[model samples]
Target: MKIINVHSASLPALLLPLIFSPALFAADEQTIIVTAAPQTLSELDTPAAVSVVDGEEMRHAAPRVNLSESLGAVPGLQVQNRQNYAQDLQLSIRGFGARSTFGVRGLRLYVDGIPATMPDGQGQTSNIDINSVESIDVLRGPFSALYGNSSGGVINVNTQTGQQPGTIEASSYYGSFGSWRYGLKASGAVGDGTQAGDVDYTVSTSRFSTHGYRDRSGAQKNLANAKLGVRIDDASKLTLLFNSVDIKADDAGGLTESEWRDNPQQSPRAEQYHTRKTIKQTQAGLRYDRQLTENDDLSMMLYAGERETTQYQSIPRAPQLNPTHAGGVIELTRHYQGIDTRWTHRGELLVPVTFTTGLDYENMSEQRKGYENFVMNGSTPEYGQKGDLRRNERNLMWNLDPYLQTQWQLTDKLSLDAGVRYSSVWFDSNDRYITPENGNDSGDANYHKWLPAGSLKYAITDAWNVYLSAGRGFETPTINELSYRSDGKSGLNFDLKPSTNDTVEIGSKTRIGNGLLSVALFQTNTDNEIVTDASSGGRTSYKNAGKTRRQGAELSLDQRFAENWRAKAAWTYLDATYRTNVCDDSNCNGNRMPGIARNMGFASLGYEPESGWYAGGDIRYLSDIMANDENTAKAPSWTVVGLNTGYKFNISKVNIDVFGRVDNLFDREYVGSVIVNESNGRYYEPAPGRNYGVGLNVGWTFE
Candidate 1:
C-alpha cells in the first residue's frame, strides 16, 4: 500500500494558477439561485461549496436514464453504474459512502422538498425521474450537516413546473445490448395563477428495458410522476405530488479476480440459483404555503409512501442445514410517512436577516421474512423455489428533529449563516419465527445527536468571493447492518455504535470568461468509523474501527470561451486512511480506505448552437482503487473516451430532435465498481466495451 500526502510541494503549483490568472476573470455570469443553502441564495453568494446542473443541458444529447451520465463533472462526487440494475448505482462524496456495498449511504437525498432517504440513513436513486427534472443542486463540505443524520453531502432535485403554453411530447431511444426506452410528457396551465380558479400541472411516464452486458443480467422498469398546483385564495396555495416505480431485474452477482480474467460477462452461480429481484413502490406528497404578515410566512409539507421487495440469492443448500441460518430468499414490505412544518421571518434586529425554523417527523414499519430458495424434487434439491419459512420479524423505526437557521448581513461585504438541528432516532424489532433451535431474537435501540453548522463569506469583488465553513455530523447503522452478529449469531447487533465526525472547508467561487470556476480544500476526522467484520453466504456483519482521516482538494472550471464553443473540467485529489491500529484480523493502521480512488478527473469540449448541428466529446480518468481494508488487491487505473452528435429543427409547426452517442470509444476494459470485503473474494464488477445509441423526440405546442 502507498500513501499520498495532500500538502506536498505540488499544492502551491495547482492553487496559484487558478487564483492569480488575470485572463480568467471576466464579467459576471448568469445568476443561479439554489435551495441547498440555509437560505435561498445565489450559487456565487452562498457560503458553502455548491453546484447546479441544468436539466435541459443534461438531457440535450444523452440517454437520460442514469445520473452517472451527467454528474461526472461535479467535483467531490462519484457516481458509478454497475451494469446490473438490480443493485442500483454506487455513489459517494469525499470518501463518505465508499464503504457501502449496495445502495447509497452517508448522504442526504431530496426530490422537490420531499425526503427520499429513509430514517435509517439508507437511500436509493431508482425513483428519480430525470426527464422531468428542472435542476439539480449539489451541496458539499461542512454546511451539509444542517440536514441532520447522515449528512456527509446533500443532493436536491427539482422538477419543472407548468407554464402558460400547453405542450405534449413523445420520445424514444434505442441502444446496445438490446436496450429501449419510451416516454411521454404533458405540461400546461389552465388559467392565470393569480386568479381563484387557476391551476397548473405537469405529468410524465416512461418505460425502460435492457439486456445487460453480463450474462443473465436483464431488467425492465416502469415509472410515472405528476405535479399539480391549485390557487385556493389570495394568501395561500397548495401543491400535490405523486410518484411510482416498478422494477424487475436479474442479478448476475460479482465475479472473482480469476473469473473476471477468464470471462468478464459470465456468472458462475447465477445460472444454478436464478438470482433475481423485484420491487414496487408508490409515494405521494402535499405542500402548502401561506402568508401571515408582512415579514412572516409559513410552509408545510406531508408525504407518505409504500414499498415491497423480493430477492433471491445464490446461497448453497449447505447453509440451509443450520437451524439458525436465514434462508436464501428474502421478502420485505415497508410503509413509511413523514411531515415537515416551517416558519420564516425576514425582520432585522442588528442588520438585515432571514430567520427560519422547522420541525420534521418520520416513521417506518416493515415486515421481513426469509425462506429456503430450494425444494425437494423426488429426493433431489431444486433451486430458485421457495421451500420452507426460516425467519420472520417485524421492525419499526422513527425519527424526530427540530432545527433553526438564520442568515445575517453584518456588513456590505461580509455575511454569516448558521444553523443547528437536534435529532433523535429509535429502532425496535420483534421476531416471530423462533423455534426450539433458534430461540427468541428481539431487540431495541435508540440514538441521539446534536448537529451544528456555520459559514462566513467575504466578497472581494462583484465576480469573486471566498468562504469558510465548519460543522458536526453523525451516522447511525441501518437495519440491514444490524441483522446479523459478527460472531455468527442469530440476533440484531445492539452493541454497534454510531459514527461521528467534524468537517472544515475553505473555498472560493469566481466568475471567469462567461462561466463559473470553483476551488475547495476540505478535511474530516471521524471517530468509531464503521467497517465490515465478516461476510459469507450472502450475509454481512459490521463493526466499528477506532479513527480515520480524510483530506482532499477539488477544482472545477466551466467556461464558454469562443462563440458556440464550451469547455468543462473537474479534478479531485483525496488522501483517506485509517489513523488507529484497531485490528479486525490484521493491523490495518495506515492502510488506504477501500473502494476509494486517489485521483479522479473529467474534461469535455463541445460545439453547440441554438439550432442545427451540435457535437461533443469527453474523457474520464480514475486512479487505482483499493478493493478491501487489508489492501491485498486493487483495480488498476484506466481512462475512457466518449463522443456524441445531434441535430435539432422545426417544421410544420412541430419540433424534432435526433441524437447519436458512442461510449468507450477506445474499447477499454476496466472494473466499474467493487464489492468491499466480500468473503468469497468476488469483488470486481466489469465495465462494458464500446457501445452505441440513438434517440428521437417530437413535440407540439397548442395555442
Candidate 2:
C-alpha cells in the first residue's frame, strides 16, 4: 500500500494535463475508462477489453439502422437483420446465444445506466434514440462480470448530457420503399452551478415508417426520451430518465430455401408475424460522492426502472390441419412486464486498494395467452380461438456482487489487477396449462456461482500496451425456458443445470507511427449447456448438454493515410465447435457449433467525413456456417456491399447534410439466418435478397 501511494502522487505531478484534459489523449490510445466501470471515460488499468463508438459515426450510419447493425464493425460479433423491421435485431457474441422468439435471449443491453434488456435477459432497444447518444461502450468476454445477468457481455449506451451552451437539433429523412423519418433533440443547463447546485435537462423524439421491400413486413415506429440532471454539490449528482416506444409491424415468417431464392422480398403468411408492439421504459437514479478525507472518498448510487411490452407473431397452419387452417389463420401471442433495481457503492479503501459492493434485484414475468378452442382460421387468428392457453410466471432473481481490485505499481511500466465477486441467484415459477395432452406443475429453482478475475498489464513503450486475464460466468434458465409446456412434456422439470463457462484471454493494443491496431485471443470452456430436443413425433423438451469449448481471435485496424482519407477494417476467426457426444449414436460424434460462422470481416476506405464531399462503401464477408447442432448441411458463404455518400452544409446554428445509401449493391440473394430442422419436418428460410435505398437527411442546431 505504501508503495502504491508513493507512485500515485509522483505520477500525477508529471501527468497533470494528460489526466485532466481530453484533447491531449491521442485517438490511437486505447483502454479509455467508462462510467459503466464507474461514469467517466477513464483509462482501464486492467486487462478488460472495451470498445467505444463515437457519436459522429453513429449519426452518419443512421441509415436508421438497428443498434446491432452498427456494431458489426466490432470484431468477433454478428448482428443479423431480419428485414422484417419488427422481429429483427438478433445479436451474437462469440456464439453465446441463439434465437429471440419471445424476447432477447442472452446478451445484456443498457442505455444510460438503465436496463435495456428486461430481467429475463430479453433485451429491448426500440427506444434507443441514438440521436442523443454521446457514446456506446461495449465490454466483451467474462470481464463483463461487473454487470449482473448476461455477464455474457455488456453494452452500455451513454446519452448526451446537457451542456452549458444550449442546443436544439432536428432532422428529417426520406428513402426508398416508402420510407420516411423525422427527429428532434434539445439539451442545455437550465441553471448555472452556484455554491449550492446546478440544474440541467434533455428531451428528444423520433418517428419513422417504411413500406418495406417485402409484403406484410411494413412497419411504423415512434420513440421519445427525456432526462434531467441535478448537481447537489461539487462531487454529487442525480439523474432521472424516461423513454417510450411504439411499433406497428408486419411479421414475415421463415421461408423455404427455394421460395427465398424466387422472391427474397416477398412476405410469407402475412397474418402471422405481423402485429403491433409497444414498449415503455421509466428510470430514476441518484449518485452521491463525498470526500471523507484528503486521500479517501466515497461514491454511492441507487437506481430503479420498469419496462412493459406487448408483442405477437403468427405461425403457418399445419399443411392440412383443417380446411380452415389451410387458409392460414393460426398464430402465437406473447406479452412481457419487468422491473429492475440496484444499489452500489465504491470506496477508496485505504488509498491504493479500491473496493466496490452492490446488491441488485430484477423481476420479470411474461404471460402467454393462446386460444385453442377457437377455430384457428379466418384472417385474424385471435378472432376465432375461443379458449385461452393461459400461462403466468413469476421469478425472484437477485445477486450480490462485491469486488476488490488493486494496481500494484511495481515500476513505471508494469501494474497488477485482481478482484473476486460472490454471485448468487434464486428462481421460482408458478405455471399452469390446461390441455388434454400434458398435465401442469409448479416448482421452485435456485442456483449459485463464484466468479473471480485477475489481470496484468505491462507498458512496453509509450505507444504499446499488452495484458492478460481470465474470469468465470454463469447463466440461469429464463422463465420461458423453465416454464414452457409443449404438447409432449409432463410439466416443467427441475433437473436443468445452470450453464457455466470460464474464459481466458490475452490482448495487445498498439500505435505504430500513424496507424492503430488491436488483437485479442480468447478461449472458453463451457459446461452443462442448455439444449432443446424434439426427436419424438409430437413433443419437445429441454435438457442439459454435457460440455463444449469456444476459441477465437479478433483483429482490428484504424488508419489515417492522407489529409482527407481514412480507413477501418476488422476480422474475426472462430474455431468454435462442440465436443463430440460419447453417448449419442448415428454419428453425433463431431459437429461444428450450430449457427456459427468460421470467419467474418468488414472493410471500408474513403474520404473522411469532414470533407465537403465524402463517399465510401462497406464490403462484408461471412464464411460458410453449420446449419444445426448436428453439423449437417454447410450453408454457403456470402459477400455483400453497401455504398454511402453525402455532402455537408451549415447555416448559422442549423446544420444540414444530405446523404444516400444503396444496400446489397449487387442485388445478390442470401439469408442472414438458417436453421435446419434435423427432424426434417421444418424448412430453412434464407435471408432477404439485395435491395437498394436512397435517403436524404436535413438537420439543424439551435441555441
Candidate 3:
C-alpha cells in the first residue's frame, strides 16, 4: 500500500491561519445535537465527520427544487444538476459514486428512518419532498461503513413534526427556462399525550415543471409526503409515513465535443427517436418504539413500496435487427419491502457504554420487458413507436444484515466507538422471452462480507478535539449494472464481483469564537473497482478494474462574526487514480478516475436580522475533470457566482417571505456533468448560462 502526502498541497496555506489564529477566538456558540452516530451526542463530541443542513436555511432565498442548490457547501460531497430531469442528479461522495450514469449508487440514503435505497444498492432522490424537511444529516469517512452495503457515505433526512399551534403554508416560485413550482404544507397536533389518543401530523404536496435549458428536454413532477405519530403510552409510540412521486421527462441525450461547441442547446437525435421516460412510485412505512425497562429500549421499522418506469431510448433500428438485441424501449415494474429491528442498552461496562444491536432484511422483485422502438410503415420504418416484444425477464434481490455498535467512555476525555456488521446479498434472474436466436438467461449470484469499523477520540481542551477512524466497506453491482454483458451476449453478467474497500481517516474539530471549524484527511484503497466498459444508445456495460486508490483532504468553516453577519467556506482536494493496468483497448494504470474533480471550493456571506431585510452572495469553484479512463478528453475548470436578497414581514397573525436570485452571473459556459466512458464519445452535458428566479411563501398560524 502507498500513502499520498496530503500536506504537499497548497490548501494548507489557506487553512493553517484559521486553525492557529488567536484573534479569531471569541465566545462559544450553541451546541448542536446530532444522531448520525448510534449514540446521541453533540457534534463536537462525535468521533466522526458529520454536517447538518437546516431545512429553513436550505429553502431561504432559493427555488427549493433540487438538492444541488443547497448541498454545495458540504465538503467531500458533489451534487450536480444535469439540466436533464430524465437523468436524476449526479451525486458522489469522496469519489465513491462518480461512475454512476443514472440514479445514485455507492451510498446509503434514508428518509424518516425508512430506507430509500433498495436491496440491490440502487436509489433515487425524486421522492424526497424538501418542502417538509426539517433537517438533513450527512455522515462521511470510515464510520459510514456501519450502515451496511454501499456505505461509502450516509444521508438521512428528517421531516418536520407537528406542534401545538397548527400552521398552514403556501409557496410558489418561478425561474428561467419556463420553470415553476408550487407547494402546500400543513401541520398540527390534536391532543395532550399522557395516555393514548394523542396524535401529531404533517402533510406536504408540490408540483414542478420546467421547459428546460436544452431543446426537447422538458419535465413535470408531482410529489406528496405525509407523517403521523401517535403516543400509545408513556413508554411506547407509533409513527406512520407515506410518500409518492410521479415524473415525466424528455431525454435530450448527451453531446459530442463538436456538437457542444457548435450549439450546446441542440438535441441531435432526440427528434428522430423521441426519447423520454415516465416513472411512478409510492411507498409507506411504519415505525414503533418502546421502552422495555429503565435501561433498555427497542425500535422497529417496516416499509413497502412499488415503482413503475418506462423509457424510450435512441438506439437506431439497425441494432434491433440483431437477434440478441434487447430493443430500445425498456419497461420495469418493481415491488420492494424491508424491516429493521434494534435494541439498545445503556449501562456500565468497564466504563460507561451504550450498546446497540440490530437486524435488517430487505427484498425486491422486478418485472423487466423490452420492445423495439420502430415499426415498418409500408416501405419506410416509423421511429419512436413500440414494435414487437424482444426481451422479458424477472429479477429478484434480497439482503439480510445483523449489526452491533458500542460507544464506550474510556476516560473523562477519551472515548472509543466500534461496530461490526455481517451482510449477505443474493440475486436471481429468470428469462421469460426465449427464442431460437435467444437462449435462456437464467442466472444467480450470492455475496457475503463482514464489515468492521473503530474510532478513537481525545479531547485536547474544552473547545477542541481530535480523532482517528478506520473501517471496511463493500459495494454490490446494482441490477442495472448487471443487466448487460460487455460481449453483447444474451445473459446476465453473473461473472461480475462485488467491490471492497478499506478506509482510514484522521480529523480535528474546534470551536473558535462564534464559529466551528473542521479538518479531515483520508485515504481509501479498493479492489475490483467497477468501471464503465461500454455505453451507447442508453445501454451501458461494466467491468472491474484491478485496483484503485482515493486520497483527499477537506476543510470547512462556519462563522458568525458580527451580530447580523455570517460567513461560510468549504474546500476539498482529491487525488484518485487507478493502481493497476486495466486494459479495455488502452492501458490506464495511472489515469485519474473519470467524472471527478481534483479540487473544489465554495464560499458564501450573508447578512440578516429578525425581520426587515436580508441579502446574501456565494461563489463556487471546480477544477478540471477527466471525461474517461483513457485520459483522452476533459472538461475545463470553471467558477460561477450568485446573489440573492429577500424580505420578511408579518401582518397580524400572517407571515410572508419574498426573495429573488440570479445564478451564473457571468454566464460562464461549462459542462455540468459527464457520461464516463461513453462508447460514442458523446460525454459532455452542458450547464445553463445566466438564470433568474423569484419566490414567495405565505404562512398562517392559528392560536
Candidate 4:
C-alpha cells in the first residue's frame, strides 16, 4: 500500500473503504460533533481541518503540565514550552504566531463557551485546569476567521459535567527536577433525573510545584475550577463556571548560543537581578440556553474577571537612565468583562438548513505602572529591588462585534457554509504620571473590520469527502505592542494599523482499514504584517512590514490495527516567508519567518487490553528553525522519544490508577523554543534532556 511510504503524496486517495470497513465502523460508531463549527456538524461532515483529543486519554499517560504533551500529535499546530512559566507556552498554527515571545497570539481560545483571548487578540493558557477538562477541540483552516480577530485557529476546551452518583477523587504525582502535583475533585448530580429540575456540579483544586531543570526557573502554582448546571425546564438550561489561578515563578531568561553550549543548566543573569513574577487571576462565567421551539434555540453567555500581575526584570540600572524607556519593574491590575448572545433556527426547504446570529461585546480596563528594578541610594541604583515609580498609566480597550452564519445542505451529499462578522475595537490611554523626566503621552486608537468566510463540502461516498474554503482575518496591534515606539518617543503608537490576511484551502479525508486519514493544502497572504523592529532589556517595539505569504500542507492518520493496538501519526510542512523587501537591522527580502520550523512530524503507538495494563510510546521530530528575520542564526533539528505505562483496577466500591512516564528518553539536547529577534542575541531556550514522572489517582463513589 502507498501508506508504506512515509511521504506518499497520493496516500489520501489510496486509503478508501479500507479505513472505514464494516469491522472498523463498530469500533468507531460514535458521532463526534464539534461546537467551534457553527453548524454543529459531525467531524466527517465539517469542511475544515479539525482534531479532538479525549481528555481522559491525556490524563492517563501525559504529564498534564503542558498542553503540548497531549496535542503534539495534531498536524499544523505547534506547541512548545519555553521552560519559563511566566512567559506561558509558545503556540502557533501554520506559522501565524511564531514571532511572539510571550503568551499566545493569532489564535482564539475558549473554555466552556467563554473567551480566553482578550479583545486585543492576546491570550494566556496558564489558567487551564487539565484535571477538569473533558475534551479539547482544535479547528484550523480558512474558516477560522469566523471567530473574529486573530483567528489563525481555534482551541475550544470543554470541562466535564457531573453525572450519576457522587464521587470524590484525589490525585498526586512526582517527577524529575523536584516537580510535584496534587489535586482533589468532587462531582455528582444534586437531583435524581437528567431532565428538568435537576442540578449537577463539579469542583476541583490543584497545586503544582517544580524546581525546574534550569537554574532560577522554579515555580509554584495553585488553581481552582468549578462548574454548576441547572435544568430550569425541559427547554432551558443554565451553567455557571468559575476558575482561579495564582502563580509565582522565577524567570530563567533566554541564553545566547555560547552560553547554552557552555552550560544549559546555568542561568545567564537571573540570580544577580532576582527576576521573578507573581500573578493572580479569578474569572466567572454564566451561560443560558433555551429551546424556544422545536426548530429554534437561543443561547447567551456573560463573563467577568480580574487579573493582577507584578514582574521584576533583570534590566540593568543604566538602561533606566533613558527617560523615554519603560521601567524594569511592571505592575498591572486589569478588570475585564464580556457578554455574548446567539440565536439558531433550523428549517427545511427541499433540504436541511440552519441559521445562526450572534452579538458580542467585551471590555478591559487596566491600571498599569512601571518602577525601577533596583533600590536607589545617593543617586546610585541597586539592581533586583523595586524602586520609585518611573511610569504610570490607565489603559482601556473594548470591542463590539455582530455576526451571522448559515449552513445549507443542498443535496444528500453536498453542503455549503457561510458567515460574516463586523468587529469594532476602541482603545484609550491616559498618562497619569507626568513628571519633569517624562513627557505627556496620552493617545487613543480605533480599528474596525468586516470579515467574511465560506466553505463547500462534497461527500464523494459514505467514507470519503472533499472540501474547499476561504476567509478573511485581521489582527490588531496589542496594547503591549503599541506601548513603545522604535524612535524612542513616548506614548502608544496610534499610527500602527491592523494586519489583514486572506486564506484559501482545499482538503480531503478518507477512511482506510480501521483508520481515518486527512490531507490539506492551504495558502495565506497577509498585508501590513507586524514585525519586531527593536527589542532590548525586556522591552520591544513593533513596525509594519510590506507583506508576507504562507503556504503549507498537513497530513494526519489514526489507525486501529487490533482490539488492543492502535497507531497515530501526523506531519506538516509550512513555507512561511516575507513577500516583500523588509529591513530591520539587516538587508532586504525573501527571508524565512523566524521561530517556526518548516517541517514537523509525530508518531505514536499504544496498547490497552480489556483488563490489566496499558502502554504507549511516541516520537516527535522537527526541522531547523530560523532565529531572526535576518536568518543569521538557526536552531538545529532534533528528535525525541517518550514512553508510558499504567495499571487500573477496582476494589469494592473504589477505583485506583497508577501510572509512570518518561520524556525525552534518549536524553537528546535541543532548544525547545526561541526568543525571536532578541536584541542581545539571547535567543535559545533549552529543553530538559530527560525526565520521569509517576502518578496515583484514587476515586470512591458515595450513594
Candidate 5:
C-alpha cells in the first residue's frame, strides 16, 4: 500500500546482509532416501518438507548443468536460468508458479514414476538426463495436496537403477560462451542375483552445445535415456522407460530496460523475424509391481508421449493482420497418454495402518498449427519464413483422478496421514481454419476438484520430530492458458477457472551431532489468483485475481565436520502479499507478489575424502524481485558463487574422474530471471558473468 509505506523502514536494512548468509542441503546426507513420499521415507521421516539431491553430488558438483545446478541448496525452490534455451527453466515453489512466462507451473514433475507433469499443469525439464541421475527428491508442504493437480511441490526424478557389472561411460565437458558437453553411458546386470527371473539395464546419451551468452542465443541439444528392469516371479515387477529429445535454439528475446543497459549480449529481435526454436520429443514408460500378500501391494503405470514444436516469433505485420492474432509461425503437435493404478495395504486396523488406493488417467491431443512468420511475395507480404495458412486448431485434453490414502501408527512416536483426490479436467477445441479471417471460435471447458490432505507426526526424542499439515490444491488453465483471449476474443477462454489452494504447515526435525535439522512454517490461501492479463509476441494472457496470500519460513541444515568436511544450509522467508483488491491498470493492493524472492539463502561446503582429491563451494542468496503487479519494478538483489575441484583415479581397471568448475565466482552481474507482467518492459533476465567448466570421466567395468 503506497509502495509499502515508503519501503517499510528499509526492511531491516535489506535483511542485514542475510545476517551472515549462504544455503542448499547435504548436511552429512541425513539418511536421504526419498520417493517424494508415496512411501519409503527418510528425509528424516517425510511428513512433507522433504529434500534430497545427490546424484553423485550432482554429477561432480557445479555444472552437470541446469536444475539450476543442484537446486541451489533448495529451501522453497526458485530455480532460474532464463539464459533462455528458448525459454525453459524458471521454476517456482512457494509463490506457486511465479507468473510463469514459460513452462513449469506450480511444480509436480517426476521421472521414474513417469509424468514429467502435464495433466494440464504444464511442466518441462528438457528431457532430464543428468547423466542417468539417481536422486533428486524435493517434496514440500501439505503432503503436496496428495498430488492431484499442480501440487505446487513434488519433484521426483530418480534414475539410475541397474545393479552391478556393466559400466561403459564416457563424458566430456568444456564451457564458457561456446559451451560443449558430450556423454555416453551404459549400465549393468541382465540376470544373476540369485535370479528367480531377472533383468536390468540403463542407457544414456547426450550432446549439448551452446555458443550463447546472449546474441542470437545459440543452442543445440540431443538427449536419450532408457531404463528397463524385469523380475516377474517371486511377487512380480516390471519397468521400462524411454526418453528422447532434440532441440535447436536461438531466441534471445526479452530486453528493454534500455535493452538491458545497452547490449546485454544484444539480440534486438535477431535482425527482425528470425527468433527461433525447434524441438522434438518422444517418451515411453510402463511400470508394474506386485507383492499381493503379507500386507498386500500392487501398482501399474503406462505412459506414452510425443511432442513436436516449432516456434518463431517477432510478430508484426500489423499483428499478422489481426484476423484474431495467434500466429507467428508456431506449428505444434502433441499426443500424450497416461494411466496409473495403485493399491497398497497393511494390516492391523486398530492401531497400525497403511492403505492407499488410486486411479488416474490422462490424455492430451493437439495439432495446432499457424503460419505466417513471413514469405509470401506474390500477393505481396514477406518478412521471415513460413507464411500463409494462418491458424488451424484441434485440441483436446483430459484428466480423471481418484485417490485415497492413509497411514497411521498411533503409538511409539505417533503418526497419522490421510489423503483424498478427485480431480477432473477436460477441454476441447476444433477450429481447423474458419473462413473470413478466423471466427467460428470453437470452445469447451470443464474442471472439477475435490482435493484433500492431512498429516500429523510426533516423536519427542530418539532424534526428535514434529509435524502438522493440511492441503487442498488445484490449478488448471494451461492449454496455453486456455489458448488466448484477453479482450481479443476468438476462442477457448471458456471463462477460465480452476485455482484453489488452502495449505497449512508446521514442522521440525532434528538429529544434531553429525547434523540434520529442518524447520518449516507455512500458510497459503488462494482462490482464483492467476493475474497477468496480457503480454505479447510470445503470447500470454490470463486474469482472475481475488484473494491470495502466502506465508513462509524454512530453514535446513546438514553438517558433518570431521570426516572430510560437509556442510549445507538453507533459508527462506516469504510473505507473498495481495490479500484481496486487484484493481487493474497497476493498482496491486498490498503489493509484493510478483516473481517472488523475498529473502533466500543457501550455502555449501564439501571436501571429499576416502578418495584422492576433492573440493566444493557454493553460495546463493536472492532478496529482490517484484517486476510487476504494481510493485512497479525491481529485480536487483543477487549473490552467487561456486567452485569445484576433483580427481579420483584408477588405471589398471580403467576408471577416472577429473573435474573443474567456477561459476559466477566474483564476476557477479545479476538479474538471473524475471518477466512477470512484461508486456514489453522486458523485465530483466541477465545472468552470466564468470563461467568456466572442464570435465572428463571415463569408466569401464564389465563382469
Candidate 6:
C-alpha cells in the first residue's frame, strides 16, 4: 500500500474531484457566484501584475487579528505599523508610496468602484475587512488604464453583497502582546422572498485591543459596516453602504540608535503622548442593465459617497530643550465628499466588434491645522518663529475623465482588446505663511492638466494568452507636500510638476491540471518623479529625480491536489534605478530607488484530515533594498514564516474555525521602514521577534 502527498504544483488536480463532485449538487440548495474576472495569468495578457485574494482565505487573516501581518506576503507590497496613531499606516507598492509619514499617497484605492482615496491624494485602506470581502483584486504597475489617477495599480475590494438566504458569523481572537478581538456579522433578505423584487442587507461589527509590544503603543479600536441591496429586476440592482471606525491609543515615538539597541520599545512618545481618531463613511449607488434589441444592451451607474475623520495628536519634541521630551501638538480635521456617474452601451457594432464608452467625474476638499509646542495642559503655547498668519484653510482637487474600449474577434483563434482615456484635473488650494518661495502668499492658486492613457490585450490560444500595452500615469503632490512651509521657508511652493510614467509588459499564462502559472516582464520609465534630496540645507527636501526606470518580473501559482492538500507560491523581482542626477554634479544619478526589493516571494502548503482539522505554514522572503537616494541607508533582505490552522463543520449552519500566526517566525531582526532615517549603523527596530496569536469563529445560516 502506498500513501500520497501533493503540494504546490499538484493540489489543483487533487481538488478537482471534491469541487466538482456530485455531492455538491443538492436539489434544494442555491448556488452563489462571484463576478466574472479578467482572463490570463501571464504578464503579457494583463500588461500589469494583478493578484487575487479569495474570500475563503479571509477567515485565517481577520481584520483585527492578522490584518497587517497576513498581508506581509503580498508581492511588491509592504505593511507597517508606526506605533504612533498620528503616523498613518504604512502600505507601499513598488516604492510608489513611502513618503507618507502621516497618510497615504501615490496609490489609488477602490472598493466596488467607489474611491476609497480622497481627492487630495490622502487614502485609507486599513478599513478593508477580510470577513466581508468576496474578493480583492491587486493590480500592480501602471497597467490599469480603465481606472484613472492610478500611479501604481488599483486595489479593488469587492464585498459580499446582500445574500438570498440569511447568514450569521461571530469571531473571537486572543494572542501574545495582550491582544483580544471580537467580531459579529449577520445578513439576509426581506419579506420571506418578496414578489416585487428581492431586498437584502448585511451588517458587520468588530472590536479589538492590544497591549503595546513597546511602551505605550497599545491600542483599542471599534468598527462597524452595513450594506443594503435593492433589486430592480434580474438584470438591475442598487446598493447603499455605511461604515464607521474609532480608535484610542498611546504613541510609540522614534528611538535613538543606541536606545533602540538597549530597548527597541523605549521612546518619549510611549510616555508623553495619547491619540484618538474616528472616521465615518457612507455611499449609495445604482447599477442597471437593459437588453436593447437582443444583441445590444445598455448599462449605467451613479454613485455618491463621503467620509469624515478627526484626530488630535500631541508629542514632546527634543526641539530647543535640554530634557523632558514632554510636549508638542498636532490636530487634524478632515471631511470629504464626492460622486461618480457612468453610462455605457455594450454591443456588437459590426459583427464581432464590441465596445463600451463612458464618462467619470470626482471632486473633494479638506480642512487641516498644525502647531508647535501645543500644550494639552493649558492654552496652546505661542512659542513660534515670525510671519505665521493663518491656522486654517481649504485644499481641494477634482478630475473629469472619459474613455472608450473595444474588443474584436479577429478570427477563430484570435481576439483583440483596446481602450483609451482622457482626463483633466483641477486644483484649488490656499495657504497662509511667510516662506522663502512664496513670500507669505495668502489666498489660492488654480492648476490644470490633461492626461491620456490606453492598453491592448490578445488571446493566442484557448489555454494561453499574450498582451502588450502602454499607458500614461500622473500624480499630483499632496496638500501638505505642496503648501507646507516651516520656520526658514524650505518647503515645496512650485507649481509642483506632476509625476508621470509609461510602461510596457509581456508575459504568458498557462493552466495545467491543478496548476496555474503566470509570468511577466516589464519596464517602466518616469520623469519629474518625487524623491528626497538629503543634501539640502538642513532638511530632506522633495526634488525630482530627473528620470528613472523600474523593471521587473512576476510569477505566481496556486494548486490543490491530493486527498487533502493545497499549496500557493509567488515570486517577484524589481529593479528601480535613477536615470539623472540633481544639479548635474551629484553622484545620486544611477542610484537604486528606495523601498523596492530586487527579489521577493511567498510559499505556503496546507493540509486537512478526513475529519474536521486543518493546518498550514507559509514563508516570505525579501531582498535588500536601498532606503535612501545616496544608497547610504539600506534594509537588509529578510525572510519570515507564518503558521495557521482551523476547522469547519460538514453539516448544519454552525461552524468553528481557530487559527494562529507567528510573525518573524525565525526572529530575523530588521527595520521595515526608514522614511526619515539614513544612517547605516544600528539595525533599526527589530522586526517583532516571534509573535504568536490565535482566533476562533462560529457561523450560522437561517432560511
**lDDT agreement with native, every candidate:** 0.81, 0.57, 0.83, 0.80, 0.76, 0.56
What stretches of model 6 exceed 4 Å from their correct place?
1-48, 61-67, 71-74, 80-88, 190-195, 269-328, 349-351, 376-390, 432-440, 443-458, 485-492, 533-541, 583-586, 608-611, 676-686
- Candidate 1, residues 1-703, lDDT tens digits: the string is 1111111011111111111111111123112123521123257876777777888888878887899999989998888888888888898889888877777888888887777788888788888888888888887877776676776787888887787889898988899999999999999998877777689888999999998999988999999989898888877778899999999998888889999889999987778899888999999999887777766767777899999999888899987879998889999999999987777666678897766677778899989999999998997889889979998999998888777776677898887777777777788899999899998888887777777777788889988999998888887888888887888767787777888888999999999869989999999999988877666545678888789999999999999978899999999998999998655679999999888898999999999987799999999998988888899988888899999999999887688999999999999999998887888988888989999999998988888
lDDT of 6 by residue, 1-703 (tens): 1111111111111111111111211232201011111111222233345666765665653435433555544566666655544345666676677655445677777665556776545687655665676666666654453455534555666766666678898988887788888899988887542334778787888888888677766777777777676666654555666666666655454454566657776654335434444455555555443434343445444556555554433333334132211113333455554544333333455546544455556777665444444332353333311111224446666766655555455665454545555545555555544334334333333333333333344456656665555556666666555653322242234544557777677766666567667777778788878754431111233555679888888778877788678788888788888898743345878888775678888898889664477888888887886656667766677877777766655466676666666666777665555553332232243345677777877878786
Residue-level error in angstroms, candidate 1, position 683: 0.4
Per-residue lDDT for 333 in model 2? 29
Best by lDDT: 3
Candidate 3 ranges beyond 4 A from true positions: 1-41, 192-195
lDDT of 5 by residue, 123-202 (tens): 78998999888888877766665676777787878888877888988888888998888889899877753355789888
Q: Write the per-residue lDDT of candidate 2 for residues 447-526, one digit (tens) a residue.
A: 65556665677888877889887777666666556543333333464566677778889988888557778888999877
lDDT of 3 by residue, 127-204 (tens): 989999888877788877777778788777788878778999999999999999999999998876446878989999
| Clashing residue pairs found in predicted model 5 | 22-602, 22-603, 23-569, 23-602, 23-603, 24-73, 27-558, 27-559
Per-model TM-score, in order, reads 0.94, 0.84, 0.94, 0.94, 0.34, 0.83
For candidate 4, list the clashing residue pairs, or say none.
18-512, 18-513, 19-511, 19-512, 19-513
lDDT (tens digit, per residue) of candidate 4 on 399-497: 887777766778878887777777777778889888687777887777777777777888899989899988888888888887888787767776667
What local lDDT score does residue 282 receive in model 2, on the 0 to 100 scale? 56
What's model 6's overall lDDT? 0.56
Model 2 root-mean-square deviation:
7.6
Which of 3 and 5 is ahead in TM-score? 3
Report the CA-based lDDT of candidate 5 relative to the real structure. 0.76
